[model samples]
Target: MVVDLQARLRDALAGSDVDELVELGCDLADAGRQEQALACFQRAVDLGQDWIWFNVANTLRELDRPTEAVTAYQRAIAAGQSDAWLNLAHVLDSLGDLAGAMEAYRAAGQAGGQPEGHVQLAHLLHQQGEPQRAQAALAPALQRGYLPAVALAARWRWENTRESADPVLEQQLRAGAGVDGSARADLAELLIATGRREQAREQLQLGAKLGQRECWLPLGNLLAGDDLSAEPGQEQEVDGAEVDKAGAEEAYRAGIAAGDEWCHHNLALLLLQRGDVRAAEEHLLAGAAAGDELAQLAWQDLHQQD
Candidate 1:
């Protein structure tokens, strides 16, 4: 994102008021010139433009400086920028200040943010082991038939109950699968769970071609015959099934290349089972460093054996 500011743009900025500077900052931010945008925003703020602290916070967040953004957001809130409360909550959540984020989210609603704030709060609550409260938080969005909220509610309920899929939710999920790699992975997983292994494989293969990272894990699992144990001389061999060990390895490697850390666990398992302990340990270490729980557990077990 190399952006060269034109002479005309520079001339415009030299004569702009605080409002114009904020507008220019927004435009620059939108165009991926976040550093330039920050400069514009900071310049405006320095000239007694106290009300534009929210703009300053947004630019800081875009720069991936969340701590600075938090301060600017608080200043914005103090200056009566109500929307800053919602934004500040997002930053706090990113910083693992969940309790603070919860408070900020409540304040956002009271001080007036979008109705979608409920959905955001609900997701956070669910993440923090308060599923009941999370469901309660979703009530407002559910009443309005917000799609993101509805889909999330369905997914959470599915995780708990494993009940038959509703037609409406299935349709929504399929639509999501068309656009999102994780959704492709989720849809393929659902198919496999319902005894449609071939369909899952086909869907995952198609999504892999679409550059979807998550699809690769399930695709590899399918190739490896869904965790079927290897025979004394053969892999996942049961009822004449031939586990495509090479194919599975390729899929796992592809997934890793595509930034899917979870693939390391399964690949490590495969290698470990095949007596390639060194390679498996390398992957386990990498996955654990990437914060993958399964890989972490496997790595711990390996250490305990030592």
Candidate 2:
């Protein structure tokens, strides 16, 4: 009886429609026959299973075929699959088709897929250098709790007004204490920008120990005093110059071994401070060649001094 039932099930699947084929392909994909599963999904789409087109598109994307995935996602959209629009936008962005990605994101926003879509659109707009449009795009997300309003507000205050006048920014900065790597890094940067160098250093030290690569550059710059590019009012002089110099040198050395460009630049500055112009030039050249703008500017400044 069991054998007969199994055989009947196999026969039924063998004569199945596009939807069944998609289900089989999904099973195959879950079982790790990714290539064969993709082929099966493609066959389902070719058989006009419009409802499964989005799933096929997502599978194609997982298989690293962004261009084909975009086409499949477009087909799904044409078949009235609104939910696939965000995935389509992400695939376009991954393919470096930023314009198309933005258009898809806008469409997704219009379809009311996710409130976060508006925030993503705003971020993309900001990346494209349209801050005003970005701000406008964020309005919906801001109202709907999809965006980090407090953080965004703090950032805006820091960017546009005096830090001293912005109590909210200070509160936000304090609220970020003991957070994860990214939050700690952000807080460190804000601290440095708001003239809390010691606090920034402490935060960065904690971040570095916690494996945050982003903190290394700012910490290195602070150590070297070469290009303390902290925002206005953010500079802090060390109490004991010699001890600070030694600590900075050690940090820079470790940072250089970790392949940090800012560390290389800081090391160069340290070398220059120690009157080793030739060695400083070598590090400066290396950092500049690696496309560090600060290093390039520093190298040019040093060349002018020469």
Candidate 3:
């Protein structure tokens, strides 16, 4: 049955007069038959189906072959599929080929495509330690309601130390936290670093209530500090211990049960500090396998002890 279907698909592809081959290629790619899909897409491109190149590029990217995706996107651009240039920039950025990403972003801009190109260029510049240049690049979009402008402005205010009490920054932090995990974590870290531990705790508490795993590590650290100092007094105590060790243990177990990587890493550290090496190793190993860098480093330290 599968062989008959394959033969039918081949005949249909062979008889394609327009872009039917591209559609067939896309279907094959979506169904996880990547090698066959690539062949079909290559044939479509050879038949002068200009639009097929973007699909081919996207498929290559999804298959974890960014270099080939870059080439495919470039071919699409050369064939006048200018709208694909922004996506090409994004693929290059994901591959850590920032120079190529910048070039593609520039081409996307020239093509009058997404305004996000400017924001992406600015972000890349900021990451490369050219904050002033990044801010300059973001200037045009700043007045146009681009969300990245808030982040860029916050970064500028932070770097310049205009004032730690800047209301603009506070507003930006709140707005940023509403958008993504990384932004919320950044705001929390910044608040803690600036001695606004209470505020950071509040933000983290809200994040925890909302079921955000990203808040657990910093929040746990904060709580651990408070625990060591005996905050909330005897009223919050559990298991006949100060700082509610029982509650902390429960939270840690809940996080572990939910498979949170950061929770596992932080909980491992906490347990290690409490002299529970066996449990610590288990959680740390799980976290390390999940790509938690801190957990991996901690595991290395543990091995050195043996």
Candidate 4:
């Protein structure tokens, strides 16, 4: 049955207070009531709250209605809220309009625009395979202490050189760990690189507990290896110590819930090892749908089986 959002709104929106409506909309959205929140935002806009269009756009985005979100974001931009450009750029990127996203990101970083736009711009450049440009664009974000930029730059260095992270970058990641889960994950990786398996587990555990669901990926691996271990009952190194298949499954599921597609691939591997071929296939498809390369390859290979 559909929710009677208007009736619910009538209980709290009896006043003409724009701020109240916006606050209620935010509260509703936080509770996953996007349609009700959308109504609240739209009502605020009808009451001359032009700035509320940004909230409407955000709600629309959360509702997976990108076309309407883009329109609402455009209206907010037209009303002189340049920060809407940042969100609009993200929507364009999600819609696969890379060039448009690039242009919109540029607009979002200009005067009166969102400063974090530069960080996202750098991220997009990286996605488009322009590493040099991504690094260059990231400079400003780094200077501003943006955790994603710091993490990306550090990752690039480690990926290209196969050496330990630079001391300064390592320190930055540590400092940012309190606020960014990725920072904790990176720090754990640095520890893992140095053969500090136990410390790495500690970092991953804390990060996962702090609501950094992505940490579950590494944590799960550190807990259970690909061997499944039910036969030989052991692997080696981090997870080699003790193969907690149940814990690994839990971690993978949590990571999947947290939007890390790669967890599906790992979880599929575990399921396959358990002789749950159908379950493995299901997770492979889910991972493929989320653009996980390993999952896509595994799915293709599985489909080609004799």
lDDT of 1 by residue, 1-306 (tens): 233454424754686577777877787888888887888888887887877889999989988999999999999888889888889999999999988998888777557555567778887888889999999988776777666666667667556765535555556556656556666666676776776777778889999999877789889988988873464356355235677888999999999999999899999988987788899999999999999988999988977998
Cα-lDDT of candidate 4: 0.80
Among residues 3 or more apart in sequence or in different chains, the pairs in candidate 1 whose N, CA or C atoms overlap within 3 Å are: none
Better of 1 and 2 by lDDT: 1
**Cα-based RMSD of the predictions, in order?**
3.9, 6.8, 5.4, 4.8
Candidate 4 lDDT, 1-306, residue by residue in tens:
125545557765777888778877887887788988998999989988898999999999999999899999999988888889989999999999898888788788774446577778887898889999988877876787766667667766655764554677677667767666766787787877877778888888999889987688988887775344343333444434656788889999999988888899989988877778899999999999988888999888878983
The lDDT, on a scale of 0 to 1, for candidate 3 is 0.71
Go through the candidates in order and give each one's C-alpha lDDT.
Answer: 0.79, 0.69, 0.71, 0.80
The residue-by-residue lDDT of candidate 3 on 1-306, one tens digit each, is: 458447746875677544566666667776787877777777777777877888889888878898999889988888888889899999988888879998777666557455577777887888899988887777766667666666656656665673556667767766756544445656776786778777876887777667766666666666665443332233443233234354455566666665566678767766766678999899889888998998899899999989
Residues 1-306 of candidate 2 have per-residue lDDT tens digits of: 446434533553556476566766776677666676676666666676776778888888878888888988998998899988899988888888889888888878778456556766776998888889988877775666442534453455455664653566667644543443444556766765667777878887877776666666666666655343433334446533323566677777766766676677777776776678898888888888888887889889988987
What is the descending lDDT order? 4, 1, 3, 2
Error of 4 at 187 (Å): 2.4
Error of 4 at 138 (Å): 1.7
Q: Please report, as a residue range, the 10-residue window in candidate 1 with the lowest summed lDDT.
A: 1-10
Preferred candidate (lDDT higher): 1 or 3 = 1
Residue 28 Cα positional deviation in candidate 4, in Å, after optimal superposition = 7.6
What lDDT does candidate 2 reach at residue 14? Answer: 57
